[model samples]
Target: MENIRIFVQKHKKVSWLVLIGYLIFCGCFVFPLSNERWSFDFEKAYMIILSYGILATLFTSLLSSNKSIHVYSISLLCTTVGMILRYIIEYGEYSNTINFTQINIIMYLGIIPVFCTLIYWIICKLESITCK
Candidate 1:
């Protein structure tokens, strides 16, 4: 508990970014989007996304620590792999006809990591600004 609090305090910006990014991602589910429904392999895709999200959150929490960058890198890698897997699955199953739709959905999932990367970039920029 103490360590977690210290981590949070030390990496306040990153922590807030993670929280906000997660909220935004979750909020996207509420709207009645056309491709919101699950398809044949919905369970697998959902599981992958859930796992990726958890890993990303954990990575963000531990990012400020000097122990290892493995966790953060793995989290990002998992997200990329999951997105690719989603695209491949959709493409293989549906071919060109469904490719566009699958691409859009996969793009939505891709945004998760992009936001995380952006958050890190923003934090770095802020740090540079503070130092200057």
Candidate 2:
């Protein structure tokens, strides 16, 4: 369909970034952190993180479009909300203290925003290129 083609063209970079970010989060954060003691079931934590990552990627893909910034933004927002919910459900329920290891802090605060900014920049670049 023409719509699908246009959507891909507009959000290819965002899609790629989301994929890479998800991979990085899984490889760099989840895998290593799973070994740490948090007084929770590791399998459950891993599943929740994995599910959030998959949902983020899926939403990003579904909302891809040149003329739908609102939709894309909503998808991103949902992804963020899902991530926060996962964090709360996993740790908050048990009153587990959040550890601020260098890697964890960077992944949570730095990498998330970097991923978002990259997607936004790529969207702007794609729009300008298509306009010209």
Candidate 3:
């Protein structure tokens, strides 16, 4: 644990990028630049799956040491793998909608994080206000 913390502190830039990568993962992935390289409808369900992953990461972060990047790295990797496996198994129905021609950028990135952050804020508030 101490070793992990030390590593992140020593490599501040990489750690910060990794942290931001986690926070913005869903936004970047879903807000498609071009429709050809992606299937909007088939892939949209990942927003749900990865949002939960973000939720798990956020709560777990509250428990990290001062250097939280270690936890974030592990959590990010695990959550990504977990989501992929889930998609493999659950890709039946959503796949049919792959022909989607458009997506709302604001709507796609706006909704879920707002809710997730609110829930995270509540948990942090609760923890700090909890009695010793």
lDDT of 1 at 16: 61
Q: Give the per-residue lDDT of model 2 (tens digit) for 1-132.
A: 346446755887886566546644443344223225654486856674555445443444545444245534543444455455555556645423444345654454444444544454455466568779
RMSD of each: 9.9, 9.4, 10.5
Write candidate 3's Cα lDDT for 25-126 as tens digits: 543344332355454464566656566455544443544423234444544454344334444544666532442223533343344444454545554555
- Which structure among the candidates has the greatest TM-score? 3
lDDT of 2 at 87: 59
For lDDT, candidate 1 versus 3, the one ahead is: 1
* True lDDT of residue 69, candidate 3: 47
lDDT for position 3 in model 3: 59
RMSD in angstroms between candidate 2 and the native structure over all alpha carbons: 9.4
**Per-model TM values vs. the true structure:** 0.35, 0.35, 0.38
- Candidate 1 lDDT score at position 89: 52
Candidate 3 global Cα RMSD: 10.5
Candidate 1 vs candidate 3, TM-score winner: 3
Off by over 4 Å in 3: 1-15, 32-103, 129-132
Report every candidate's CA lDDT: 0.49, 0.49, 0.47
